[model samples]
Target: MAFIPLSVPNMAEKEQEYVLDAVSTGWVSSVGPYVERFEKGIASYINTPNAVACQSGTAGLHLSLIALGAEAGDLIMVPTLTFIAAVNPVRYISADPVFLDCDDSLCIDPKKLRSFCEECCYIKDGALFHKDTDRRIPVLVVVHVFGNMADMPEILKIAEEFHFKVLEDATEALGTKYLEGPLNGCMAGTMGHLGVYSFNGNKIITTGGGGMVVSQNAELLQKIKYLSTQAKNDELYFIHHEIGYNYRMTNVQAAIGVAQLERLETFIATKKENYKLYKELLEDIPNISIMPVVEGVRSNYWMYSVCFENSKVRDDAIKELDKDKIQTRPVWGLIHEQNPYINNITHNLEKANFYGSRILNIPCSSGLTIDDVKTVSASMHKLQL
Candidate 1:
């Protein structure tokens, strides 16, 4: 009977137990057992060899780029349709992002990606370079948009040919997996050179505000851990060999994370079931379509979205839904169009802009009951009349 909020954290687990333990033992800051336990636990879950805890997903991304040798004047390929945070790390490294478009799955388009690498870029001295700018494109930031996997096999093949590192932005796709192809059974984040996950309050699992950087490369992960903790060669002596950051995730947050990770599978199942119910409820609505998970991927259904015919229809639904105490929101605007990134070069963004105006994200928080879905669906159906 009350307004349904969009994507709130689910905390019916050992969150209290873990956080209380951390507080009672004076391990609430960035030091203590929970941080290492949380990092190791996440690495085990995702099948990566290592994981480093960090302050936020953006920090994880920045550290990953730095560890992987991102330099000034470098070009990193990113999807224009993704959240702005995914591209901001490129700027953090003094590198620029070349905006690529998304396909129907709302992830980076593999075909366009190939075309850009082969037709638009020229190879020299074993590096891929943009013909016009001559800047080396060494990394591709592929986001698993809304828990759906991009065409990673195709994307990986292209990356191998062009020699670019793949950094997966798995902040919204932690539980997703590829069910088919060369990467069959590979988790979304584990497939890339380095993958980053967010445990913000809105994620399937929450550490209040924290992130993890995972990789099969143990050495790379160690460097990230070093950088995350101020790059101290000797903690007792306070000797710093290189520039680092205070991006470590607090022990209290990691304690919460360890608890949250315990219930991740159940949360993912709830999300899948809720998404199915929404699909069934909204199927008959006119001039609207649901964004589907890709064919070979098992998505976590992190955020359920609907595409309307136009912005007017979407805005009308938002107004009607809110009036009925159901909160709904439009998808983020195209990142390239933002004020800070307006002048950046964007490849064929036809679909990005098309979905930008038409897509709406509906309530699908982990704790959402079937009754809540029914109420939200009924309110949304009213807009079709």
Candidate 2:
């Protein structure tokens, strides 16, 4: 049997066609038509007034921190249970990150966030400050883990009450959205003050390596665009007033992204089908369960995950599956546990610690066949016996 791989890109003929057109026109650099078209495509789909294309999701987050005025000695609230990229950008701006725990949905916990605010922080002159660090808390970075939408309604309320900005890391959840509540019909990245999406090879869509920042605040997005292009005050003559970055997405990458965006909904539907199939196949198995999305949210179903009874079982499954040529992986190590963030402040991380150990991501690639999923399920079932 062929290897049933993990999440990978699903490309179409349009990707090749657009990429060839971009190469033929000699407009393959950052300044070209495809870049603008890709930006517009994302903006229209997400219903945002402005979108700025950048090099990667990390770059998007870095630019967002800078645009939101995150400076040295400021504290940015972040979830400990996420890819390190989400928290590293806070350090890039010379700001300290205060790690928060995740709820059952594997996104930032709203209860802990509020409790920390009320118990560990104080509001002075309308600005929230950490009691121990005594640093200004300017923003909260919420990541929609594994395409599941975070509890934006609750998180936003906390942010409003504390007077801080919200930056949504929707890199893994491009198409996920709320189905009910005050955020009905609102997409994952569109609800926050600033939201970013990634077109990495493994995301719902692929641009090889690209990202975008979207917001209702057009002026802030314009400033991000300026900062991305090296912060040049004058194009005719080299002029620089502030440090900038070469974070713009190339037209070639954008060409691929435009093609990928056209098929995002179809890709999401395939993912949904595969996830349902996995659930049905493994439901009867003992000491194992599939993680679920939050209620009333339409997840992109980006990567299907299985939770074992414990870490040993999860690790043993990965080793056992490899013998059958089926690829699987454990969840990312808690970000706060990383060497650089060892001393960072944390609040009530019980759930994050619990889920981080036992969760194993399974194959849900859009191109995966039913037979492939069945083979993986069979192998997983045998592990429990």
How many clashes in each candidate? 0, 0
List the global CA lDDT of all models: 0.91, 0.93
State the lDDT of candidate 1 residue by residue for 210-254, as single tens digits: 999999999999999999989999999999999999999999999
lDDT of 2 by residue, 1-385 (tens): 6787887889889999999999999999998999999999999998998699999999999999999989988999999999999999999988889999999899998999999999999999988999987899989999999999999999999999998999999999999999999999999999888999998988889999999999999988998999999999998897988899999999999999999999989998988998999999999999999998789999999989898899998999999999898989899999999999999999988999999999999998889888898999999888953
The TM-score obtained by model 1 is 0.98
TM-score of each: 0.98, 0.99
How does residue 183 of candidate 2 score in lDDT?
Answer: 95
* Index of the highest-lDDT prediction: 2
Candidate 2 — what's its lDDT? 0.93
